[model samples]
Target chain A: MEIEDENNFKLRPMKCELNYLSRSDGSAILAQGETVVLVSVNGPLDIKSTSQSIEKATLEVLFCTKGGKPSVADRFKENIIRQTCETAILGCLYPRTGISLTIQELEDFGGLLTCTVNCACLALLNSGIAMRHMVAAVCCAVSEEGNLVLEPSYTQVQSASALLYFVFDSRERNLVTGFTEGSFSENTYEEALARCRLASDVVFDFYRDIVKQYSDVI
Target chain B: MKISIGDVVLPGDYCEEISQVAEKSKVIIGPGLRKEVDRVYITKPGVLKKRNPGTFWVDSYQKRYVPSRGENVIGVVVQKAGDIFRVEIGGSITAALSYLSFEGATKKNRPEVQVGDVVYAKMLVASKDMEPELVCVDSHGKKGRLGVLSDGFVFKCSLNLIRKILNPNCPLLETLKNEWPFEVAAGMNGRIWIKANSMRETIAVGNAILGAEYLNDEEIRSMCNNIAAILAGHVS
Candidate 1:
């Protein structure tokens, strides 16, 4: 089957560049709307004996803000990203090794979590680390007008009543992560979940495009 | 998605062709493709490739090396234990190189191997839970093209580039073979050791290999031609 392009996508346009770093094993810079993130993946490299796991490779994730010292919120984001990626990476393939993922936030207009998760997934793909499946993250906001805005901008998020971020794996489209802020009705939450799930397909298509472009060039 | 050969596949995509062949005969599934209970799944983002009767794998670009048994690799000896040497092959851990595994080495006789010396050896035992072991001699006790590589420069590159130059279809090695009198050893771990009459010829070989990393077949041919011409004093 022919791979579908993202022209039919209603979410904000995405731009990405893969394998840009000279030192990192794999790196990618992804910009979703105004939110830009740079991510790099290295390993299964030699692991320290202290942190080695006999059953599987240890995953270490570091989240960096644009500048200054990391705050509690950054640590929280790191946990979320680490959990989401750990689920996807087949860490058992390289037992006693460590896979390190470093993410630097460049621009955070809105939907920071969604953009970060998506960019992290792209970096993992570029690293060629075996993963059970790929993941796509979508952000939606419930505006004061009682309408859901997909991939809300800074101003859109400020005026919105609630914001939701959902990460879905490619296989089965299962929800791997979900984060929300403010209050919304149960019915509205379900509606946002469905819409985010559909929007995730656009991100997956974007990933396919990036991989296909690089593979063809090589 | 029902993936066919040559299709750009993603992790978790299904390939029915392999399952159909499995019912009749055995198939070799390489890296990037995993066999589940009932079907075949791609675990990488790249083109699904097939060879011969039934060998399928996804050719994804990667840098990190995972030691696999029977693959020849170049490593640097890091530590010297009583009976074995710890060689760092860019894997998860240092591989053990037993002294007795060398050619013509007995308990009383030891090969003059030193720390930080580069060697081309074959992986004898590479298991997930066990330490990887390297051997300098073949089963026949011959050290043919697999031993201490001295007086040569070594450089690291992506695993994909190593595979590219080593492939029979790739013109990289074929083009360089005619350029100059040089000896080269490429390890699957992405280290390449090269030696020639002088530094100029050695650098030329290294240049040709590194330059071919991103170039297509046509471009690589011209690049090799240019390097060869420059080295022969035909062009300055």
Candidate 2:
């Protein structure tokens, strides 16, 4: 699946960053082009729980705007990120206590969900919240002329009929989370998935570059 | 044979006296009955020995005071022992203000003074006792700028910047001439007190004060919002 320029839609600028704060265990700011989101992770810290503290860690998520109000779309995005992050995080080691994560978006040009999840992954690493592997997200827009575009921007996404966001953990090349079309045929969905896997490689490479740049400072 | 304060004598200047009048020299060199002493001694050639004498001078590391018959000095009240309050005049030694010194104060009020309050007063007397003593009074039987500033915000910055801001022709200074109504007390020690202004105006002045150091126009634009935000108290 290819998202073409003739469709008047293009790939969004993937503006992402990691380990942006020192006070938190993990923190990152991901700006998917114009969409800027700040994500922070607070540890598997000590929590008073009776008896059942030995088995699995808990996950807690909070979402808010600059003024602390949760919009409907923000709530939807928060739930998606929470579910996706829970899948990627190592939930067994931190028993009894729930690790908390907060996502705040200052500016949203487009592709907010993808950027929020990507930033959450980096924030988990920054918080030193243990994770099975690093993960990344990219939104792909399928153009009318049968071209698959990776990381579609706000304008491109609006112009396109269908937009799909793929969240993947690079270690196992596993799909941790996914969002896509309902009306398209199975063939097109499969093609978009294939393109998504390829698009994920680009995000993974970007993730590795970020880690390499910040490894020395860490 | 007698030494006084601010006396200039040479190094080995007392050497001859050390032999002939050892007692008097001992009084000068050793701790004597004097409450305090200030002497400038330079090294000179010894009479019996052959040695070269070089000429070099250095001021003492101890505190130096500059007071005319009437010059105002600001001091911070640091201690209260018995009837006296010890005021630190930006130096190692403190000046004492006795209860009697507050003559103008009525008994009902009793001129309440406390530690950490900055007081401005004229030095009626500066003499050595156990330490330097200062009386807060004027000869015409009147109180001058001899009161305590007990409440306000205090911050420290370079003294040079303060002087620059106080300069009337300074562009940054001109911009803030009456923009913010604030009484600023700039100290030689770099402590500045900016009191009672709208938070917005105070921050604007602070930013403009900082802008004096940065001469670039474009560079300042990037910081303009931040400066405004700081004045707005949006950014802590």
**Model 1 per-residue lDDT tens digits across residues B65-161:** 8899999999999999999999999987899999998899999999999999999999999998899999999999999989999998999998998
Error of 2 at B210 (Å): 26
lDDT of candidate 2 at residue A35, scale 0 to 100: 86
User: How much is the lDDT of residue B54 in candidate 2?
Assistant: 18
TM-score of each: 0.97, 0.44
Clashing pairs in 1: none
Q: What is the TM-score of chain B alone in each candidate?
A: 0.96, 0.48
**CA RMSD for every model?**
3.3, 24.1
List the lowest-lDDT window of 10 residues for candidate 1 chain B.
B172-181
lDDT of 2 at B87: 80
